[model samples]
Target: MTQPIPPQKIIVHQLGRDYKSATRIVDDILQDPKPGQIRLRNHFAGVNGLFDAMAMQGAIGYIPLTPPFDLGVEAVGLIDAVGEGVKMSVGDAVATTGLGGAYRHYQIIEAAKAYKIPTATPDYLAIVPTGISALVALEQVAMLQAGETVVITAAAGGLGHIWVQLAVNMGCRVIGIAGSDAKCEFVTSLGAERCINYKTNSVADVLGEHYKDAIDVAVDTVGGSIFDALIDNIAPLGRLVVSGYASEIVEGAKPVLAPRIYERLYWKGASVRGFMNALLSEHHRDAATRLFDMMHAGDLHISLDPTVFKGLQALPDAAHHMMSGQNIGKTVLDLRDGV
Candidate 1:
């Protein structure tokens, strides 16, 4: 094989209190892979709005870094340089997830952090980090069971859509809540038993009239009023999984008067649990394996937004687009041409 070359990368020269001002594209020289590291030619990088925003504002408590740091957490690529002691070889396809290595055309990553994949495609961006979150959160945290009824907020989104399909495949009846009629239709097409247009209809009223005391598991990414409504409608021993607070993340958390958690949950023996995929890193490999298997078996489908962002320069705009809630599915930055 021919020798691989270094590539350009995105850097945060100064932290933007918001997404737009945070990042800049720059030419970067990739260092040769160190011992136990493998260099990758990144094909596509995943855009996670919440993480991008928090990372820009220096709110990522777990992996603190000063300015002039790289951004992005996940990507799919082919190995171009394998360092001494690394078992991977040139041209091997892989998916890697770690902070600060993805938004570049080429990445030098620890071999242990990279997983061999069947193909270097943008789809793996959905299957690895995003899909695994759905799998682990529902299976491990919520302990979702077959034949139960699940209600998912933001159910037409990247993560929520995966959850809807997974729940349906597990023999669960799913009620999906989306913001628009188009999104509701999309969620319904994913096999949700019902797709509620939360913008047009009252979630609480609909649940109260038709699904009151019947939701066995509630997965909420949008918090605020939607979360409170789910809390009020959970069945006996139901599990409420709090995966994110997208609403609060963008609009800021607002105060609302609602029944206390003790009042809403204690009477039914139900429980509310919060899940962060980062906290369940140990299971990521297994979860990714399972999700890929499902995808290959035609039991899983990934949705990508119609608009595609290209090159490191598009990162900030992509983040802003996602935060604006205009994306129907996963927002991806395509770097296959190394732009």
Candidate 2:
């Protein structure tokens, strides 16, 4: 009888600012699942740029990194083997999210961590935590209402795109913010009433002039000046959900002498909230279910970036493309190579 070949996976062997300096792709012996675990033949792995950077650089204290750690997050795949006492069987499709074991040809993971799905596809990667974060920030955190004026930053990207549609679905008027003319158009096409190109137009100027005291909810991913803009013009009783500071992820926070936050937030009864998806796991199952139903019912659109990065060897380039803020939508690595 022929023996099965080992699978391959990527790991961060050292702490470095760049992917090439920090990571190594190595062959992984495909081991059978332990009890209460499942072995998945990963079809696609989500490329999360911000998390990758933090892991690579040891930036965040909670996610402590030692040498040679598993280096990817969410993935969609098919179960090829299940361990003793496990319910998931061979050929069952699944999606798994948390951290690590995602950028591989196969993954042996805890059964509880894997969610059974109808099909193993890249679309699941887009909506699981990505869309769930948007949903949670909108509904649970922001308490968004229909007809509310909403602003979404980096609106043409993966997470931002989902919220734009979700807000529109809720009957909210959306003002999107992007980096370029084409991105602005893309955001508008996704149902945003308008998209401001920050490179061309001052975000603060635009919002202060037209949207001042009108934005009911602002979901901001790109921080820096854009965040200032959102806060400066927020309406009375408005809510701002800080989903990410993508702009500051790389450089760290720049020192800016600015007015106290309460000065802007105090009188209006407005507030700012930070959202970290992992810390809000209790809401995940419900959010995922809602998003999946929306997708299945044709009420949601999953946009995958056109640039293809196939195989484990392409991870560095893929991670860089996303971290550099170049991707149009969800950036995923196709793991079907030589499978």
Candidate 3:
């Protein structure tokens, strides 16, 4: 028998039952070969809450698939080889988001789905569309205005930290609410004027005492109890944006009532808008490029303090760490360092 050359690939064959469960990475493409696509050599994979939720929910019947699947949304890498009519070269560094299965060493991507990141950008900086999602959710969906007083829950996290900086830069007085004093301090270091310790102090008291009035906007990243608490602090005509529900991932969760929330919104003449960073087509690329421009101009600063897991095996541990709030900043998998 003739020997075939080894192709490095990170494969996720199945989904796990719990948040702590991990995925598997194999050395070959497990799926039946699909026609007309190019295999890409992976570089880096950006991790976020969406990927975690999808994995835990076990394929929600939207993507036309069953269990035992590859699960990753976005990654940055280069095209290794091409199939029929594919024009991209072997060395193009591109960013691919959406259509899960990105956390691998090599995988096939449609040529239209990949956006080429400029050569001048660094890998660490280029792998920042997760932050871009936060920005787009805030600016596009919420429509925050200048000189507004905004409250950002979980303000020290990957998305929350970016929200704080973006709000601050937009002339908003940012009140960052974090789980710990250290996290609060971290948000403050990122230009938040006020950092609230939700664990120690009461949300109502802090908002009333410091803000003296209802806030113009509230960006809730960690929902559940904290989101409920924010309801009492919104100003008339205040806008509330819900991005993630980190608090619900832990045990003993409950559903929030929409009618009551709507009642509160109506009583205060306020608005509660739900937004996720799942935009289609050019919107993702547009947001990413805009954020990069801000990064290049030194106007925006992102905290990359979390641990960088090397290789595909570390992916499971990294996901657990992020889900548990053990990660400080952006948690990403460095796929290029090893297979």
Candidate 3 per-residue lDDT over residues 69-109, each given as its tens digit: 66666777777777677666777777776555466677777
Ranking by TM-score: 2, 1, 3
Ranking by lDDT: 2, 1, 3
- Listed in order, each prediction's TM-score against the native is 0.94, 0.96, 0.85
> Residue 58 of candidate 2: its Cα lDDT?
75
Candidate 2 wrongly placed segments (more than 4 Å):
1-5
Clashes of each: 0, 0, 1
> After aligning candidate 1 to the native by TM-score, how far in Å is the CA of 88 from where it should be?
1.6
What local lDDT score does residue 221 receive in model 1, on the 0 to 100 scale? Answer: 94
The residue-by-residue lDDT of candidate 1 on 119-226, one tens digit each, is 998888887799999999998999999999999998888898899999999999999999889989999999998999988999999998988999999999998888
lDDT of 1 at 287: 94
User: Model 1 TM-score?
Assistant: 0.94
Q: Specify the poorest-scoring 10-residue window by lDDT in model 3.
A: 119-128
Backbone steric clashes in candidate 2, count: 0
Q: For model 2, how does the per-residue alpha-carbon lDDT over 1-339 read when each residue is reduced to its tens digit?
A: 545446888888999987788988888888999999999999999898888888888776566778778888889999999999998899999999866779888899999878788999899999877998889889888999999999999898889889999999999999999888988888899899999999999999999999989999999988998999899999999999998898897789898897789989999999999887777788889999999999999999999988999888888788888777688889989998675
